[model samples]
Target: MTTLPDHYEIVRERNGYGSADGAVGPVPAAERRRFVAVDDEGVFDRADRRRTLVATGVGMTGPPHLGTVGQFLTAVALQEAGLDVQFVLADLEPYHGGAPLDRVRRLAERYRTFALDLGFDPDRGRLRTQEGAREVMHTAQLLAPYYDPDRWTEDAGDDSGDTDPPPTEWERAVREAYEAGEDDRRSGTAAVARPGPSSEAADIHSAVLHGADFLHPLYAGDYERLVLQFGVDEHHLVGMARRFRDAAAVEGGVAGLYTRMIPGFDGTPKMAKSIPGAGVSLATSADEIRERIAGDPGGDPARSPVFQAMCLASRYDAERLGRLERACEAGDETWDRARSEYAEFVVGLAERWRATEE
Candidate 1:
């Protein structure tokens, strides 16, 4: 584990991260809203004050990318704000997604390394793999009885990646097979709607299991507050905190931290390694970072991934962040210097990670 600062206090690019922007103070007109919008900010704020456990729950299906670190950055904020952090590695999930078992296993094994390189504090909270979590599996079984197939699939949503095709009833197929495989299956009590024809039955099943895994800690009566950091698209997962409120009553409060996914270098909807030139090369240098920044069509910082990356790299460097954000909004030349400095930070990160491997 690397040494972490007492607090990652940075001049936020936006006012409230996931709360009311003006609730605390005044700022830029555009700074009012957060990159990730939450419908129930009031309740979430109440939970935020309690001892919190910040967690990232996602399958290890892809290589490390710029957007992946964004969640870590959010974790750093929550941790610095005094929340414990947990990295939920859904290692068993790729089995359902049709990804290679060996590849996913390797990714899962190296996830801790990735988190450390990204500056996660291990002593505060450690990474837990889903496949090995018996309690989580038990909790998933308990949760399964609560979710009929229709409701489960409806909430499951496709969660399709950029390269993935349309939804096509993927949830239905997976749930049915999962229920069938269950030795204690109940008929006519599962899903009402039939899923679209797709062979990927395990994907939805794994998601259900994975979601249950994350919710388990909250209901287990340990942590006082649990904050989950997922992408904007996965904000619906936040609703789980609501559902678990009754169960959480004896346990703790739960909050959701959702961040905007940075766009690709060419400004795709979200950055991914599969996005041709839009991908973040693990071997990128300071020069490559400059090119990406220079080509950026800076309009709203919310939509600009380059600018967002600078914000994440800055971490606790609030003054530098404020200057960058102010310069960016006004299209000032200071943004150039900001970009150069940010580029160094990005390059330094990759070098640190690379050196760790050596």
Candidate 2:
């Protein structure tokens, strides 16, 4: 019989001691919220250990953005707070359709270097590409059958004898739009703006038209397989994470795996890379960051893009940054002043952090 790690004890105390049933009466909102709050007043108690942190995300395309920086800060905070941290770079999410395979390879190399530049270890708490973790993919495949077809569809195609045509009007419209785009010279307004027949669009169509076919099945299956492979149920996994935290407490406690979903500059929703003007990238440089910050119209300083970047960057204490954010939102200050202040502050913070680490 395999015994749980000594570290597993720590994981249980912080995350495992909870009810599986999604109920709230026994657990107050304040208690539940503590699981995520990381500020000094909330739960960054410098003495509790039982947190284990892991971050997983797709990184096979596009440049690393401020969102990636936010995740890095999250991991850094955990490490600073004394938790064991693991950062997983998910690169297996298909980056190419058919051609340009070499481009994908180059992008991967660039991103790996970028990760290193950002201070993540390439070995210890370093990167783990999706390709490097095939078990995760396999697990996803095994769990496909458990998902409801109405809620999920697979890409089994005609092999499964499910040859039904696009069922919804939206899907039909998408198909028509795709077919109409074959001729580049099509001139109508609809033709001009129609979604192109790119593989990206095709993948979207497959998901919308088929549902749960490509990834959902894998997720549902692999989750169970992972539980067994690790010799722990869903509840146990939670326990392990918490136990890891508890064990780390003796050396200044540990930071839990909590992430804040910062909203976009427009205050509409969470900043998304795909949404036009939804976010700024980490590699956006000081000039771009300043420009975006100076241009935002949100009244609450807390909602200013500059402030958002600072928060995401974790460069300043929340209280001070909150004040700056508010000042920007109130229109009491000019963009130039705010931009100058933010840029200096960010540069100083980065220097201090690097020096301390060294």
Candidate 3:
């Protein structure tokens, strides 16, 4: 496995993002580096902090996991750095994958309460569901013409110059369907609604909604810029939005900050909600969470989900985490000790928030 730093460097180069070496107020370069990459540091440096909105979200198909919690905390970090933040609960995005609206809404409510427990202040910013946001829905419709189905299909073909192929329309449809099925499995429901018949239309529709998800604040809230934070795999979504922003000649620009992913315990590339038992979640019992974290014999800190959780999700400072990493790499007992502590941290968080009546 690639070391964490080396992995992020490769991703930054591949996506044409600048080196993650800048500070947001007292946030510092080392702290920003935790996110891995950004579309342009200059965009961030130039923006008026009060007028810029830092946006991030997760699909409302399930409970919060380590990866998603990390994202929410990252948003809070930016808010602490003196910028406005918007944490979207993408209730509508998963409807394309066949997630029932009622079930999705319930998950969104739970997620909202959980985010508050994790320290997101609505007084400083916003946390909203896409389905309830009529302005965003209207903006999505306005931007619908900017998406081109033919171009995306061509880009996914064999003749394309890109080494990494974009997901074909059918592949995206299948992915959504699978995610919807995961929702069903997690909720213990046998049957549920699915997307519309045309896979191509569903794919394009999703792209449009995504574009609006990024731009609606700029359009409706009158924010001057958007700094989108997402996992590296979703870089294409940022690219698509950038293209739309340019084609439509929108007033403000959209910049990106990409973060590293934790490999799933089940051996998938990233810890994903669509896969059962892939990573630790706040909804499970304390002993069960510890068993899941400790039972896995993670060989190296770079490859360990526990260490990645500490880096991404926990409030561990950069210095402490760096020391732990170096010590673990030198083949000491640091990793064993650190992993036990991380397990307890996660268990405590779960007990505190998941037990809430809300």
User: TM-score of every model?
Assistant: 0.68, 0.50, 0.82
Question: Ten consecutive residues with minimal summed lDDT in candidate 2?
Answer: 224-233
Q: On residues 8-90, what C-alpha lDDT tens digit does candidate 3 reach at each position?
A: 66556656777666634445544564676777676666746677778888875566778887887887777777778888887
Q: Which has the greatest TM-score?
A: 3
lDDT of each: 0.54, 0.40, 0.70
TM for candidate 2 is: 0.50
- lDDT for model 2 comes to 0.40
Candidate 2 lDDT tens digits, 82-102? 434445453434332332546
Off by over 4 Å in 2: 1-53, 96-99, 122-126, 135-258, 265-270, 282-287, 333-338, 343-358
Q: Determine which window of 10 residues in candidate 3 has minimal summed lDDT.
A: 152-161
Q: Which candidate would rank higher by TM-score, 1 or 2?
A: 1
Q: By lDDT, who's the top model here?
A: 3
Give one digit per residue, the lDDT tens place, for model 1 in 1-358.
1101100111012112333333312222233223344333543345334445566855565555566666666555555545567877777766565666776676676765777667677777757787767887887777665544443343543222123322223223333344442422234443222222234557556756765766777767666666666765465465554453443333555555555555556535445543445546445665775677677655566556667766543463556556666777766677667666666666766675555445
Cα shift from native, residue 349, model 2 (Å): 12
What ranking of all candidate models by lDDT puts the best one first?
Answer: 3, 1, 2
Q: What root-mean-square deviation over C-alphas does model 2 reach?
A: 14.1
Task: Estimate the TM-score for candidate 3.
Answer: 0.82
